[model samples]
Target: MTTGQALVAVRDGTFLPGPCFMPCVDALLYRFRLVPRSILVMGPVGAPLLPP
Candidate 1:
Protein backbone atom coordinates (compact mmCIF):
# COMPACT_ATOMS: atom_id res chain seq x y z
CA MET A 1 0.00 0.00 0.00
CA THR A 2 0.93 3.59 -0.53
CA THR A 3 0.63 6.28 2.11
CA GLY A 4 -2.91 7.29 1.19
CA GLN A 5 -4.15 3.74 1.19
CA ALA A 6 -2.46 3.11 4.49
CA LEU A 7 -4.10 6.20 5.91
CA VAL A 8 -7.48 4.92 4.79
CA ALA A 9 -6.77 1.51 6.28
CA VAL A 10 -5.90 3.13 9.57
CA ARG A 11 -8.96 5.35 9.50
CA ASP A 12 -11.07 2.27 8.96
CA GLY A 13 -9.26 0.48 11.80
CA THR A 14 -8.43 -2.44 9.56
CA PHE A 15 -4.67 -2.22 9.54
CA LEU A 16 -3.91 -4.92 12.05
CA PRO A 17 -4.61 -6.30 15.50
CA GLY A 18 -1.64 -6.94 17.71
CA PRO A 19 -0.42 -7.78 21.20
CA CYS A 20 1.81 -4.70 21.05
CA PHE A 21 -1.32 -2.50 20.76
CA MET A 22 0.41 -0.67 17.94
CA PRO A 23 2.67 -1.82 15.18
CA CYS A 24 6.38 -1.16 14.76
CA VAL A 25 7.34 -0.30 11.24
CA ASP A 26 10.25 0.74 9.10
CA ALA A 27 10.99 4.46 8.84
CA LEU A 28 11.07 4.37 5.09
CA LEU A 29 7.41 3.37 4.67
CA TYR A 30 6.10 6.91 5.13
CA ARG A 31 8.32 8.50 2.53
CA PHE A 32 6.01 10.36 0.16
CA ARG A 33 4.99 8.55 -3.02
CA LEU A 34 6.84 5.42 -2.04
CA VAL A 35 5.33 1.96 -1.81
CA PRO A 36 4.50 1.09 1.78
CA ARG A 37 6.68 -1.59 3.31
CA SER A 38 5.05 -1.38 6.73
CA ILE A 39 2.64 0.56 8.92
CA LEU A 40 3.79 4.02 10.03
CA VAL A 41 4.06 4.71 13.74
CA MET A 42 2.42 7.91 14.87
CA GLY A 43 2.11 9.04 18.46
CA PRO A 44 4.01 10.03 21.60
CA VAL A 45 5.69 12.81 19.76
CA GLY A 46 9.48 13.12 20.23
CA ALA A 47 9.99 9.47 20.93
CA PRO A 48 13.71 8.82 21.16
CA LEU A 49 13.67 5.48 19.40
CA LEU A 50 11.50 3.26 17.25
CA PRO A 51 10.80 -0.43 17.67
CA PRO A 52 13.60 -2.79 16.78
Candidate 2:
Protein backbone atom coordinates (compact mmCIF):
# COMPACT_ATOMS: atom_id res chain seq x y z
CA MET A 1 0.00 0.00 0.00
CA THR A 2 0.99 3.59 -0.45
CA THR A 3 2.27 5.56 2.55
CA GLY A 4 -0.89 7.68 2.62
CA GLN A 5 -3.14 4.62 2.48
CA ALA A 6 -1.24 2.93 5.30
CA LEU A 7 -1.60 5.98 7.46
CA VAL A 8 -5.33 6.06 6.87
CA ALA A 9 -5.52 2.39 7.82
CA VAL A 10 -3.64 2.92 11.03
CA ARG A 11 -5.76 5.93 11.92
CA ASP A 12 -8.98 4.11 11.21
CA GLY A 13 -7.86 1.02 13.09
CA THR A 14 -7.07 3.00 16.21
CA PHE A 15 -10.26 5.08 16.17
CA LEU A 16 -12.73 2.57 14.78
CA PRO A 17 -14.02 1.43 18.15
CA GLY A 18 -15.14 4.97 18.93
CA PRO A 19 -15.63 6.94 15.78
CA CYS A 20 -15.70 10.14 17.85
CA PHE A 21 -11.92 9.90 17.98
CA MET A 22 -11.74 10.37 14.25
CA PRO A 23 -12.21 14.13 14.41
CA CYS A 24 -8.93 14.60 16.18
CA VAL A 25 -7.18 12.35 13.73
CA ASP A 26 -8.87 14.06 10.85
CA ALA A 27 -7.97 17.48 12.12
CA LEU A 28 -4.36 16.51 12.45
CA LEU A 29 -4.33 14.93 9.04
CA TYR A 30 -5.98 18.00 7.57
CA ARG A 31 -3.49 20.30 9.22
CA PHE A 32 -0.65 18.28 7.82
CA ARG A 33 -2.30 18.20 4.40
CA LEU A 34 -1.36 14.55 3.95
CA VAL A 35 -1.31 11.29 5.86
CA PRO A 36 1.75 10.70 7.93
CA ARG A 37 4.21 7.91 7.11
CA SER A 38 4.58 7.10 10.80
CA ILE A 39 3.17 8.34 14.09
CA LEU A 40 4.66 9.04 17.47
CA VAL A 41 1.92 7.99 19.85
CA MET A 42 3.24 9.43 23.08
CA GLY A 43 3.60 12.84 24.69
CA PRO A 44 1.22 15.63 25.78
CA VAL A 45 0.75 16.68 22.18
CA GLY A 46 -0.31 13.22 21.10
CA ALA A 47 0.95 11.57 17.88
CA PRO A 48 3.27 13.76 15.90
CA LEU A 49 3.89 13.26 12.20
CA LEU A 50 7.04 11.54 11.10
CA PRO A 51 9.27 12.51 8.20
CA PRO A 52 8.11 11.23 4.84
Candidate 3:
Protein backbone atom coordinates (compact mmCIF):
# COMPACT_ATOMS: atom_id res chain seq x y z
CA MET A 1 0.00 0.00 0.00
CA THR A 2 1.00 3.59 -0.45
CA THR A 3 2.09 5.78 2.45
CA GLY A 4 -1.19 7.62 2.24
CA GLN A 5 -3.08 4.36 2.49
CA ALA A 6 -1.01 3.26 5.45
CA LEU A 7 -1.59 6.58 7.15
CA VAL A 8 -5.29 6.08 6.64
CA ALA A 9 -5.09 2.57 8.06
CA VAL A 10 -3.21 3.67 11.13
CA ARG A 11 -5.60 6.52 11.62
CA ASP A 12 -8.61 4.25 11.25
CA GLY A 13 -7.25 1.91 13.87
CA THR A 14 -7.57 2.53 17.62
CA PHE A 15 -3.88 3.30 18.05
CA LEU A 16 -2.14 6.49 17.06
CA PRO A 17 1.05 6.41 14.99
CA GLY A 18 4.28 6.22 16.89
CA PRO A 19 7.68 5.09 15.62
CA CYS A 20 8.45 3.25 12.40
CA PHE A 21 10.34 0.65 14.42
CA MET A 22 7.19 -1.05 15.59
CA PRO A 23 5.82 -1.65 12.14
CA CYS A 24 9.25 -2.72 10.92
CA VAL A 25 9.36 -5.35 13.64
CA ASP A 26 5.87 -6.53 12.79
CA ALA A 27 6.80 -6.72 9.14
CA LEU A 28 9.87 -8.74 10.01
CA LEU A 29 7.83 -11.19 12.05
CA TYR A 30 5.40 -11.79 9.20
CA ARG A 31 8.26 -11.87 6.75
CA PHE A 32 10.13 -14.89 8.15
CA ARG A 33 8.03 -16.38 10.91
CA LEU A 34 4.33 -16.03 10.22
CA VAL A 35 1.61 -17.27 7.95
CA PRO A 36 1.46 -15.95 4.37
CA ARG A 37 5.18 -15.12 4.85
CA SER A 38 5.06 -11.88 2.99
CA ILE A 39 5.79 -8.23 3.71
CA LEU A 40 5.90 -4.96 1.83
CA VAL A 41 8.08 -2.01 2.94
CA MET A 42 6.22 1.13 2.06
CA GLY A 43 9.04 3.67 2.34
CA PRO A 44 8.71 4.10 6.12
CA VAL A 45 5.99 6.12 7.82
CA GLY A 46 5.78 9.87 7.12
CA ALA A 47 8.10 9.53 4.14
CA PRO A 48 7.68 9.87 0.41
CA LEU A 49 7.18 6.89 -1.90
CA LEU A 50 7.35 7.19 -5.63
CA PRO A 51 4.72 5.22 -7.53
CA PRO A 52 6.11 2.38 -9.57
Q: Kindly give the number of clashing pairs for every candidate.
A: 0, 0, 0
What are the C-alpha RMSDs, in order, of all predicted structures? Answer: 12.5, 13.3, 9.4
Output the lDDT of residue 2, model 2: 100
lDDT tens digits, residue span 1-52, model 3: 5999989887657344434556676677777766443334443543444332
Which residue ranges in model 2 land beyond 4 Å of their true spot? 1-17, 35-52
Instruction: Kindly give the stretch of ten consecutive residues in candidate 2 with the minimal lDDT sum.
Output: 36-45
Models sorted by TM-score, best on top: 2, 3, 1
| lDDT string, candidate 1, 1-52, tens digits | 5999889888557424532354333334455535454334333443446552
Select the stronger candidate by lDDT from 1 and 3: 3
lDDT of 2 by residue, 1-52 (tens): 6999999998778756544666587668757867543442342245345433
**Which candidate number would show the highest lDDT if scored against the true structure?**
2
Worst 10 residues of 1 by lDDT: 18-27
Cα error, residue 18 of model 1, in Å, equals 17
> Which pairs clash (backbone N, Cα, C closer than 3 Å) in model 1?
none
TM-score for candidate 3, please give it: 0.28
Model 1, stretches more than 4 Å misplaced?
14-52
